[model samples]
Target: MKKISILVTAILALVFNACSTDDEFTFVAKPDPEGIAFMNTFLPSYILKPSNATNLAERFVWNEVDMDVQTTVRYELQASADESFQNMTVIESDIATTNQAVTVGELLALAEEAGLDTDPDTEASNSGTVYFQVRAYAGENPATTVEQFSEPVGITVELVEDTSGEVELPKIYVVGNFQGAGGYGSDWTPADGVPLAASGPAKTDYEGFVYLNVDKPQFKFLPTNASFDGDYGDAGETDGVFTGKLKQEGEKNAGTPDGTGGYYWFKVDTEKMTYSLTKVDWGLIGNATPTGWDSDTDLVYNPETKLWTLTLELTEQVAPDNGIKFRANDGWDINLGDTGADGTLEFGGDNIGVPESGNYTVTMDLSNPRDYTYTLVKN
Candidate 1:
């Protein structure tokens, strides 16, 4: 009986070892994808924003990338101002598809999104180039395989002015006793005040940063550039709410700040007849900033220059990508970045990249809302 049991155990052990040996794994090599080609030809170098049909600009075609494996191959086209494709928008369907076409309207929107000013009325508005590249990958949706990118191709895009006769709104300026005798209110004249420019595309919204040095018991808005002919008031109220004549008529009263003296950002809406004053607290944040994309570092505001300033030393190890952005009140709701990568700051623009790692004296000029500039001086 013992010999029979031993024979059975020996037989089972031999079967297990045979199965394990057969299961040993071996790798299969798959060749990388190659020979990606753009099939579409004669792409328009420059195009105007399309108003109607027949304006479809270009159809991007590329030869299907071939890998040794026989699975599904997906393609994606991306466009960006930066050739590195650090920040890009997918040109065609985000899904696994090929042969994408862009219409004039679509191209214009992409141009604007890429930071080229599309406002034809502005003197700074101009045409610019955008970079494009195609990427091929294999596998299922949300592909896990490595992607191969084709060489980037660039094309120039032109911005067409809007001939729609957009309404031009009056610029608002603020003047008060808080500005002091020789400051914004020197000689008690209405012309000596801080000009409030339009916030964005809205015609009736105005905003600006001002210093209320003295205990400002009163302040008023001038509709004209430097005239008091048409102004606004708070109906003799000491609250932040503003009323009175936005243009050259009506009679309300003057408005006052909630507190006596401090740096403040005033936003007034002529269409809504409303106004708000928030204490300005600007900070820096981003992957390239000293705070490392998470925290905010305060920027000092110079009353005389009306600019936010910050001087800091940056290193390549920490700020590998030379990127930073300005955010107000330690929040992302109100932030500014370089749209054109041309030192001009725009709201919610691209990340501002530093030329090199060094001590930089950064200055943000908000004096002109229509034309904001950020100057970086390396020392």
Candidate 2:
């Protein structure tokens, strides 16, 4: 019995020892990591230019792609003029809370809404160059964060000086009867006789020939003739007319009569203006056929006297369905008459015949009137 008891005790001791050893060498499960291993970063690739003369409405863009991470991501947009971003001014500290993926355009829009000037000029005013950086944070932990930065974008701001004082604005005058015979020429008068003066209201015995002055010699023919009916008419087709004549100070005596008083086609002396006429297109009236009117001859410019002479041979007047007109300034269409197809006939110097058949607004950027709208059409 004593030996059996001793054997039992030994067995029990060995079992206990094995249990202790197993417990000492046991494996433990490590805490599962909460965040993802791979993350995508986004940075701006391009910077947009700013408007001239005004420091408004500029933008920058960035793009970010989310890695199928489990944790939500937060984005921060930081900006600086310096690459180092040492003084790193934050144009947009907290832009928005976006999904794992976001577009730079959206971020830029946010920046704009946050009242940050993305314009290069505005940025340059504060700093020479602009830089952008984006950082993604995994929840509140810095350990699971990634950052990206963009290249340095810089702009050179120029201070524009006003040199307009060198050339003074010439005096402008409007010398035509708004209410005259409204065709091409009926009761038209030469602006040459009209001295340089401030622009104002004027009238004429004829129906629709009102003229306004530009800093340079310019005039506009309004359609106001009874026979006009706002449609195309010839020089001699109807009583109402709108025509321009150029005569020198003493050439009035030699003026040729075309049913109007004592004026020929108008002349512009380049010597007085310092610029020679290279091209001339009278705004065609109505939707005239065959386009332009018959030329007497190509108007010749006298460089010495700066005078344009109407010495060309006048052809048998073949009036277009529309009369050619002029604005107070060169290159601008005459806006005095109606501007719509029904209101006024459309005319354009760039009009082509046939397949491109349509009326076009005569667009001209005149130095005189800021905006001059006119039309040309094919009859």
Candidate 3:
């Protein structure tokens, strides 16, 4: 019986040893605290409030995450006029919060307490440009571990004019769209010489205007003379002299000899001060049709109008027959007027004028018949 007991015990010992040897264990490596994984920790995207206002404060909010271990988070908001964020002034720094998540309004209030502007409803005392950015911290070592930084946002405060004792003149000139003139030809010279005293009688046209400043009665061109060729006579009159005079304030008529090559010239005198001259072809004004027509297409300066009228003719019959369309650089649809006979359409709008001095495109739909494009530019 004792021998048998010993054998059973030996078998039990062998079984225990086999079980121990067959059992396997595994372990996961701990994340490196000072490695790139620490620097690449995830953070929430941020948004700013009062995006369009001059006097505005910033606010922020973040996503919430739950972990088995307790974690601490702090925030630092920085601002500067530059994008690099170097030497940025700290708007709010080391804002302590134990909460895993916070609302944007609460964050803004906290920022206010930390000496940030806070009052987005309030107007700025002065007008200028401002930029902003923010950095978030996770873990106990808030000083060195920044989870992420937000993209910068910028705002410009426009300056208000104080038009008290000052006289406001027309901001721009409308000089094209002449009635009895052709393309004004490709090569013409702009007349340049000393202003002749109101010779004989003063003349006037829809194209030119005079400004009388009493102290400086002079005429300035919308675009400088350097913009156009220096020729001012009939198309063929390379030698004929064109003459006109400035009578009063806004009157001046210069005559051009009648001919295919006849051109015209005039001078602007400002008592003793400096002045300039500008010219525009009348035929080049107004909106063009799908005929590929364009104003200033010849590289000439054409006056712009707050109102533009376009005429479209459709010779083909198609459902929703493609037509010309005008769009701002921002891709906003401009107003298109009514359609006349045979797909003829018109478009007009106020404040539809180009806001800046640059090149603009007018698109024509070639999917239909007689389709083309025209481009206009302002100098």
Candidate 4:
């Protein structure tokens, strides 16, 4: 009887395993007909100006999309010169989030591509409309039928006629609790804050390096050096945004520091309305230095001058293959190089030319935002 029972149990287990394989399910997402909609409050019209080119054209937010079956949704944001979206340019692709930020500079590029000109002297209309659309789809390479595209939304962009050759680089000031450490003045004082340089002519993005002495130090962003009239606190989400209040009023976005802070890369995006602080240590690496492309030499930071300094010997280097770049934390994730060989540093730019093989005092000045520069002074 015992032998028979054992044989029966084995048979039952085998049958259950076969049934489970037969019931295997593969979830395929179906395109939702309702589609996605823009949730942002549209401006009457976008009057673009070179002076405020860095400002955000708009922060296009939308509700979460649906794909019927349970699966991950990928989004793509696009802009076109016409309502038909025949000649469209992708702004963001494969985004899991439901929001996208467009900058004036970005729009200017689109307008230029659309054959629209800001120069009133020309025949092209100074004012025109740009259409935007959002696409949601699934699977790595989804079929056309599985893609859900939103209805085209038009935004009017008027080019402000200007020949002044004036383009204001947008600036965002930082006021934090670790003020005295890096000559940042009194803690939490907007009037004594440091400026985070705009990434370029675009004012929506800003970046800079700062030293924070305290652990978990707190900070805030100010638009000007006068008062906290137009300031930003943490927006509650990670990698922060402006919540429109101050910490004194118990505003939660007091600023999230990288706990054990020393030297950090501070970045802010007004279009995205977010701020971030990344701790880093600056180093020099390249085939120009002693270690070639394998290692990095340390660079010292001065609080008073807010510059990175290093005095070392460099080898004579020829272009296209050999040279140096300023990288952080001994990694290639963040690095700066001279693209134009014009003393200005551009992120992931080309290699800088060695003024020849000799001992020189290298000075890296990132203190002034948007104007990153380096100097090689022979001893």
For residues 58-134, what per-residue lDDT tens digits would candidate 3 score against the true structure? 23333322221234445555554334445445545555532122223223322232233423344432233333444
Top lDDT hit: 4
Per-residue lDDT of 68-121 in model 4, one digit per residue for the tens? 555567777877765656777777777788887777777766666566665646
Error of 4 at 28 (Å): 44
Q: Residue 100 lDDT in model 4?
A: 77
In terms of TM-score, which candidate is stronger, 1 or 2? 1
TM-score of each: 0.49, 0.21, 0.20, 0.58
Compared to the true structure, candidate 3 yields what TM-score?
0.20
lDDT of 2 by residue, 36-58 (tens): 12223322222322112111223
Tens-digit lDDT track of model 1 for 1-379: 0000000000000001111357764322233435565666543455454332114467777766555444555666666654555676665533355576655544555555556664665654447656667767654434345455555455666655556755233356777676663256473356677777764332457787777776544577776545665467764333433443333234444544454567776788765667777766888777656668779878897766778899887544322244888888888887888876887877787778776788988899877745778887888
Q: Which runs in model 4 stand beyond 4 Å of their true positions?
A: 1-166, 199-203, 236-250
Q: List ranges where model 2 is wrong by over 4 Å.
A: 1-56, 97-128, 150-379
Q: What stretches of model 3 exceed 4 Å from their correct place?
A: 1-69, 96-128, 139-144, 159-379
Those runs of model 1 whose alpha carbons end farther than 4 Å from true positions after fitting are 1-169, 185-188, 199-202, 236-257, 316-322
Q: Between candidates 1 and 2, name the one with more favorable lDDT.
A: 1
